[model samples]
Target: MAYKSLLTLASSAEGVAAAVDAAARVALASDAHLDALALGVDRSQIGYSYVGSGAVILQIAMERAEEEARLNGKALKDALAAQGPDLRFSLDSAVAQLGALTDLVSSRARYADLVVLPKPYGKGSGPEAEAVIEAAMFEGQAPVLVVPERGFAAGAAPRRVVLAWNQSREALVAARRALPFLKAAEQVVITIVDPPAHGPERSDPGGMLCQLLVRHGVKAEVAVLARTLPRISDVLARQCQDLDADLLVMGAYGHSRFREAILGGATRNMLESAQVPLFLAH
Candidate 1:
């Protein structure tokens, strides 16, 4: 189905423009309604219990929270006015305290067709971005598009899309969630790395997926690449660069989150290396 509703989160200076641009680009391409949420972190919520704090301190804490929200809201609005003036959109702000941010973003994301996250997930990202991404992917059950933190390529569009294939449940879910994009894209390639020679995928790793997508008019081609690099994410990123892909569609956290985190899994690796807009589902 075509994406009719989209949500985006922006909080910091580095991520605000990129997040908004990604959302706006998709909304324009799909003629969708866009909702931009400007997020401001309220550190007091996570820092102090307030059991020993005086009334004056509590008041100051609340005031600080409100001020952060207000500032982020204004920044989001300015970006929207400057970039998305002709698009159908609404701007809102949230005072995101640590513990409560998950519930807030999840609830908002529940109604969106796709949620646009600002930065690529990995090291050096803020806690607020991580929380919002978890809420959207796990709790909200929505496909998320993580855009570049700086901006998109000058003339690139999502028309050239690549889907990483592994025949896992997570892969299937990600592909299903990204169907709308595949159907609309001018070119779609299903890239598969080394395959098991003894399994059902012995002869063709991504052929079955291509067959299914063909029925849906996706018209995807299969690209089976040998893993020359130690990291699969490196291979995928190199493939995208080779193909000049505008978007990379792949599954997130195929294994347990803890295992992935500890082992430096594909999801984590890709999050750190993706050069294009990355679309994922858990």
Candidate 2:
């Protein structure tokens, strides 16, 4: 579980500085070589409303978008420097249509142990960013550390870690992948909310996970609580705050992704309102 290489996505779009900052800080903390990628999006796909305007206006709008995109790359580089020390890392940029850009990012991400992505990994972070996440996880077959837009502070390594456990394939994958962090953490908590009473977990919820961690030499505490709130993520957030957890490791989209997209499941809710760094794997 020791990460030797890390890839961070710095989109040449607006609102990506915080993710770069967090990635730089994380790169500085972990014993891993860092790859910083500056992704540029096609302006044509950005604003379709420009189609209704005259040719002159459309040309002007495209030029303006290109200029802003250029500025976005500069800002991302500045963000890496603003990490308070000269970061020793390699920087690269990719400029292509949305379809190609995702493939490009995924190709680069294949060499890295973890892909660092921006949180709210939905429409708000832009379509390109969303594509990057899906590509890295699903296509590249790598885990993603979803950083918040607010960014993590310097020295953001996990001291206290929280594992959102449920007896599902996705959850099991996340837990096993997160063993490194759990072993390094001073405190680890296996938090389960509203366990299903009719399954094998009817006897002991989260106990098997805690025991599995023990086999890996990681001592963890377990907490099984009711869904006091509407969303499971809300309950996990409260637990993270109480435990002062710096990192949260959990599975992403155990159910149908389309269902979660429409009905708003734990993965979507957590992505939208993440309070700390979330490590996710499919």
- The ten-residue window of minimal lDDT in model 2 covers 43-52
| TM-score of model number 2 | 0.84
TM-score of 1: 0.90
lDDT for position 30 in model 1: 82
lDDT of 2: 0.75
TM-scores, in order shown? 0.90, 0.84
Off by over 4 Å in 1: 45-51, 54-61, 120-124, 153-157
Model 2 stretches astray by more than 4 angstroms? 12-17, 43-69, 84-86, 121-124, 153-156
RMSD of each: 2.5, 3.5
